[model samples]
Target: MKTTLTVLLIIQLYGLASCAIKQHYFINQMKTWDEARQYCRTNYHNLSTFINEIEKQQFLQDAVNQTSDAWIGLNKPSGTWKWTTGEVTTQISWDTGEPDNDFCAYLHKDSKKLHDRDCSNTQTFFCMKVTVNTVMVQQSESWEGALEYCRHHHDDLASLSSSRSMTDALSKITGAQTQYVWIGLRFLAGGWFWISGDDLILNVWSSAGPPQCPAQNQRCAALDKNTQTWTPRDCEEKLNFLCFK
Candidate 1:
């Protein structure tokens, strides 16, 4: 029997519930940015990161207090601003005339805006607890079609950049119709990369080591539902996909 590749473009399913967002918490204790981050990591997921204006406003409304400035997850570690989740900061809400010479960002209690400060500056902070990080779309689509649908409807296709993220992604795919589900991993420009811009540092590949040079058609990655490991597959093989939100 010969297997044929099929390209299926799926329509957006509006009725499906979106992926769970992070839950923010306010800690009133004064601590440096590093201290705050450690506390958040020890207790919750990480320092709070906002992806949009609505999320920012909701976090501020719930987590901001009048007593002190608050450290968030935004920081410039190597001259590039990034969230602790490994995603680069793009939709920022910096205060006017801010981010001068500083590497860490803190939320102003009064202004409700982000201002850059020294990492050593003592302040209260916000932390977030991520519940479900991605949503499994049951609709089957090719790798390119899945990427397009995910980018159009939510964030990029899910990127299991860490062990915890891989666990989170695994939890969402129990109901997938396909044996393997499409992820954001792709072989491109001579290397494998995540569409969300996270480093492919965590190795969850199966027994087979990373493919040095995959076949032209076998450039997309999918997660084996039983093994919970990543494997390269034909880009045209339609499968249910996970989308980060």
Candidate 2:
């Protein structure tokens, strides 16, 4: 029994360390998207491209410190967005019917999605080193409090976009976990969606399907580590959570 407990502890710590993300610099100075790109290339890696909530939160926190919206590495100038480094990764989480008639984009905290705007619009920007980190919050708390804890300590709660990502996150669960833990899944704007603005393409809800749509009383979602399925629970329900950084 002691050996088993030791193994679980080791796995938990190793999971957190394995997903650690690279650092980023918050340039609170407002600049055009093009200008920001040049500045990032010259001084840092490049305009930040975030594939998951962990990276997105890093930039979002930086943006909040500034006075206005901020330009990220995401842009759909012409049609599709290409990172500042010139690689065109297919992973894109767009708001409903977005990426229309715009050359540049900025991160919106309210919707937590890429909103297209004129490239010339000057805004603060973020430059990231390109990395990902995952952390498990063993402290039980309500969903809202869990969010606050994540923001105050690491990033936001873990958001799963793809099956691979979800599976990877589930693997971090070490010991036998009977209770549900909070994730970034929630019902918002008339549909189930990830807090990171990622589309709700993959869902492993209960056999009877997920809880009723347009959830009642600010209901949030949690991950059943044992079953690896999602379930809607009261926002006030205190539970352990997962945070990505």
Candidate 3:
């Protein structure tokens, strides 16, 4: 009986460990910001783009054994920050009037904070693959239908990265009669990401991450009417969607 119970426990643990999460490759060799970007694009995805504390922590943790700073996917070419993920970066914690230089962003080796350097500065960089796959037309689509349409049209279902962006997505829903639209909020491997990610900035949730793991069926997200918060819903449900240009 004990042996049987041990086998059952092992099965449960293995099941919990499995998910659709994709991993990215990190290179230790130092190179300039543009060189690093070229290398990452040729070999893997763009430089790393982190949406929240979870991703930030994961990126840092992956480099726990590293010995130098690294270039990320953020750049201020025209005096504004832009993430390679195509999302406008509005959620970064600046370090004491940072971006003091306006070229590239890198994770500081010792501080773990961000600092901008000249684009030509050579540094080790993190490279990762773009996993949020697919595309669709700029029209009304159900969650599943949208997923299908996106896959067919070279778009993927939409994902809002934070609570603030929730309002931006909400603006796309034209009529009040339209109950709610689908946003790319998925649950896998014990965490949430925007394609399923959110850092709740409101006072309602104590932490930046989701307050709790959503129910199994509640794998998609929509705005909550009362508190203006985002909550997970069934993916099969039809709703308005927001997409990038």
Candidate 4:
């Protein structure tokens, strides 16, 4: 059986893992904020928008290059800051004394924080593609088999890295044939990890909490449909599973 100590060490790196819940694209070409937005919409989904600190940190580590300050998806329209998704800016990652009455936001490469600038200023920008589509496969298969199936047919096993993704996954599993369904979560090497390489940012474990060290065969994670929580289960057990596409 795997020991709890081994698993705990892996949990410490949960937030450091990389996955495709959100993808950032750096555009080196200089363009005005409006021009950058149009370019992003034409090529990618939109300009980048960080949903939380974890995402912000991950983006800095994964995408930001040696470029200077760059345009993000934040802009003041009608005297209010909003993301490219049209969501009003709530959580702030502003640098010291920022928003200095400017109408557009740029991310400083050094501080990795948001600062306002004139909308007409030309700069390289970042674009992002956000996708969290989860599909429940009613076919029952063991954890390992399911992983292979998903990798062959779809993107990978579903990774609920956030509350929104969790909710989205839940919606697809309501009609699942099994009470528990395999997700991308698995205890491997020394810790539990998402097979899809996603960072485990959400805490949706059962009331009993995650097993520190599961038994040799009970190292895989499954989602409890009725309770909407995660639980360790035997990897060999056959069950329905979710896939990302």
Candidate 5:
């Protein structure tokens, strides 16, 4: 009886260990911001969606062995905060007074704390790929020029009818930080609209607000630098655009 009981206890312990969540890491090196993001989404799951405090703590602990910073799926284009995974940010784990719309998001090496960064700057990043494979691409475009550029190259700016579509798009183009691309979206007729003319459904505007309708003189849209939200600006203003095929 004693031997049988010991065997059963060992079996129970094994089952508990099996149920524990498995954490994986990818120490990607020498990739642009966009490329790093794409790598994580395509190779792993969506780029490290840290929704709660526990996950954030675990991620930092996991990265304790690493020496460089890693890139999570947080970016501000045209003044809107979005995850490369395509799911809207229902919850966030930013450090106190963080995501101030400075420009970008980075994970510090020592503290593993995430910081907002400028999109133009370059940095190394770590990508957390999940067991479930998903991808998405959220393009940022404002004016007719950028819109035309995307239409000419990739499909219209990004549209997410469901979470699956968002994940698929993100997986396709993970690493991007080199050049910004254009999406199939713009401010038209006093409202936010997609190139497909779909209703303004998924609103992810930053702190400021949505892009205003283009004025007669100003025929384009540009993201506000301070707020990281969309606003009406001259299309002629030069800015890097995001494109996905």
Candidate 6:
């Protein structure tokens, strides 16, 4: 009996450790899509990176029970789908016939599924906080200007790789109404593309598909308030941009 009890105790301990290894991290509050993206980038490496279908399912299950709609690291810039962490999407478990290009990406609580959302539409975000040292440099330029500034100084704008990283970045710069900052993302050409010219293999455009460039000369991108997805806007338009060291 004593040996059996010891074995059971060991098994229980092992189970606990396994749970910790795969624990889901989430923010306690809600935030806008841009704000949430920045939040994750500042503290963590990037937005939370979903490993596989099981991890994605577990995140949805945990978020459904929570108050806020969690933010995943998915974004469509220039009609190209990529994670904030600069990693190309490999595995996707979207609902049958999902990621219809509209504007934004969201998670449906009732269905426990993911959907595209408008960039401007505000929603609650879930961030996974992690420990990392990040450095921010100041630049005097508009959002698009800042992107140019980063290109001149360092690599492209910051990228979100994981969900925990996204949460951590969001937590660091919480508060104030003007929390949204520009990322390396922008809509260029007719398709949603990135600053680094990385091809977006994972597409999550809204139902109407991606928005067409207003003009042939439109090379810059911005989040259109009307659509919420990255649209080819005049880069000269005034907006906020985020720079990383």
The TM-score leader among the candidates is 1
Give candidate 3's whole-model lDDT: 0.58
lDDT of each: 0.79, 0.67, 0.58, 0.78, 0.49, 0.48
- Per-residue CA lDDT of model 5 for 1-245, tens digit only, reads 53344235323321111111225474657666677666665555445545445666777666676667666777765576665543335566566667776756777776666778766566676666443222222443333445455546654334332233344544444443313323344444455544432234444354245546556545333333344334455544455454434
**Pairs in clash, predicted candidate 1:** none
Best-fitting candidate, scored by lDDT = 1
TM-score, candidate 1, is 0.67
Model 2 per-residue lDDT tens digits across residues 1-245: 53344234323321122243546666888799989977875565567775555755765665555445678787764466765433344656667887778878777656666778899988888776534555777788877678668766886677765565566668765442337888877664466766654446565885556566644654588888877888888877888888887
Model 1 lDDT per residue over 125-175, tens place: 998876655889999998888988887898668877656778888888999
Ranking of all candidate structures by their TM-score, best first: 1, 4, 2, 3, 5, 6
Worst 10 residues of 3 by lDDT: 13-22
Candidate 4 vs 6: which has more lDDT: 4
Task: List runs of model 3 lying over 4 Å from the truth.
Answer: 1-24, 132-245
**Model 1 lDDT at residue 49:** 82
Candidate 5 lDDT (Cα, whole model)? 0.49
Tens-digit per-residue lDDT, 27-139, candidate 3: 89889998998787657656877766667676766767656888888887676787765445767856666868567998877877788998897889888654442122345
Give, for candidate 2, the lowest lDDT window spanning 10 residues: 9-18
Q: Please provide, for model 4 over 192-229, each residue's C-alpha lDDT reduced to its tens digit, 9 standing for 90 to 100.
A: 76754444546799855667778888899999999999
Which stretches of candidate 6 lie above 4 Å from their native place?
Answer: 1-24, 28-30, 43-45, 61-64, 130-245
TM-score to true structure, per model: 0.67, 0.48, 0.48, 0.53, 0.41, 0.40
Better of 1 and 4 by TM-score: 1
